[model samples]
Target: MYPDELERYHRQLLVIGREAQEKIRRSSVLVVGVGGLGSIASLHLAAAGIGRLVLIDNGKVELSNLQRQILYTVDDIGKPKVYSAAHRLSELNPGTSIHPIYADATPELLREVISGVDVVVDGLDNWETRIIVDKICYELGKPYVHAGIHGFYGQLYIAWPGKTPCLRCVFPRPPRRGNGDVIPVFSTTPGILGLLEANEALKIISGVGKPLLNKILVYDGKTGLFDYVEIRDADCRVCEE
Candidate 1:
């Protein structure tokens, strides 16, 4: 990062360099669902110097969230995720603009937020919402990064609209909701995947290393093993013709 930008980003530029810093400064990302996944993704992006971040989440912060939603503290309980997240994000980096959309991600809702955004990140709770996001990203020709955490496992992939396969091509259906209830989970799982999503976002924005296009990076926290699954489907409704 340039000396002037360094003065702004400080520690962030030390990690990503000036060029990546500039890209982050000029990019806009819309993150859906400000829970465990969205919380840290927003934190890292804001701290990393992303210019505009639109965070959308309809849920409210509850006491149970304290274990993983590091962005919020006990005092924020009962507050909408968007409001709580925006408050914390503003404190994290005042220079990074935050636009909090306190609503669920429906087709229409997403369309409104998707405008002018360079990328979309799925920090959502369910596969139903993910499919909506995938179609919207495809329609708008924007890159969409998908991240999900189930118990101790988390996965992420960058869906480059028209170039890489969308989430549906790999899973074919939204994962059944509440499956996490049946799996064992540690708070650190989402933390890892959320940062991975942020890393993919930076790579996409920075024109740096190759993105996680068409390949899902799966993390097994129990074993600390990372696996990549190549995904391609010519019949993908969202990204394929």
Candidate 2:
């Protein structure tokens, strides 16, 4: 770490120590969406000195996004989300390298991107894409931190390839949704889940705390309560190789 980097991450170093901090500095992460959850998770990861971040999204900033997506402003409404987010993150931490991919997360792209990253963080809104990501991460034997938010509720889990139940094990099939249907969400739902995603990633990278492992954490913002569910391995094609 350089003198400026040391000074910039001094407070975190006090908590995680120099060795753990160095581990964080050398880690690379792949974030598959740049919407509400991705925006907040990537922001904290960059600030925490992640060595590299690969951001993927195929959308532009919109006025409606202002309600929950904190990465953009009104002036950025027309710009690509990946570009705008990369710019903001770079400004926050020049020491961390940011790679913005402006495209949908296809299986081919996911395999390529996941190959190089140390961990995969889910910021996706749809189950189709999330399932694809989870499958690829399991195939590649990478750690994946998954989180989903909807209408003042959220769920989080960390999937470890062979050690823990994969996402497919948890959700054998995705819930039904009509095409082009909009999901209702509270402004702070993603904020809370995104921070939890970042926190879990940091724990995995720095070896400081226990990763979520085989537990699914659920939060209900309506009642401000959090609950945990234990996950056991089942006959899942993705991880039952």
Candidate 2 lDDT, 30-81, residue by residue in tens: 9999999999999999999999999999999999999999999999999999
For model 2, name the residue pairs that clash: none
TM-score for all models, in order of appearance: 0.91, 0.96
Give a tens-digit lDDT track for model 1, residues 1-241.
4565678677766676777777888999998888888888999999888899999888888988878878899889888989889989999888789999887677898998887799898787777888888888877889998898888889888777667766777777666556345334489988899998988888899887778777889899989999998775634664444
Model 1 scores a TM of 0.91
Candidate 1 ranges beyond 4 A from true positions: 1-4, 8-16, 177-184, 232-241
Worst 10 residues of 2 by lDDT: 232-241
lDDT of candidate model 2 versus the reference:
0.91
Q: How many angstroms is residue 163 displaced in model 2 relative to the true structure, after the best TM-score fit?
A: 1.6
Best-fitting candidate, scored by TM-score: 2
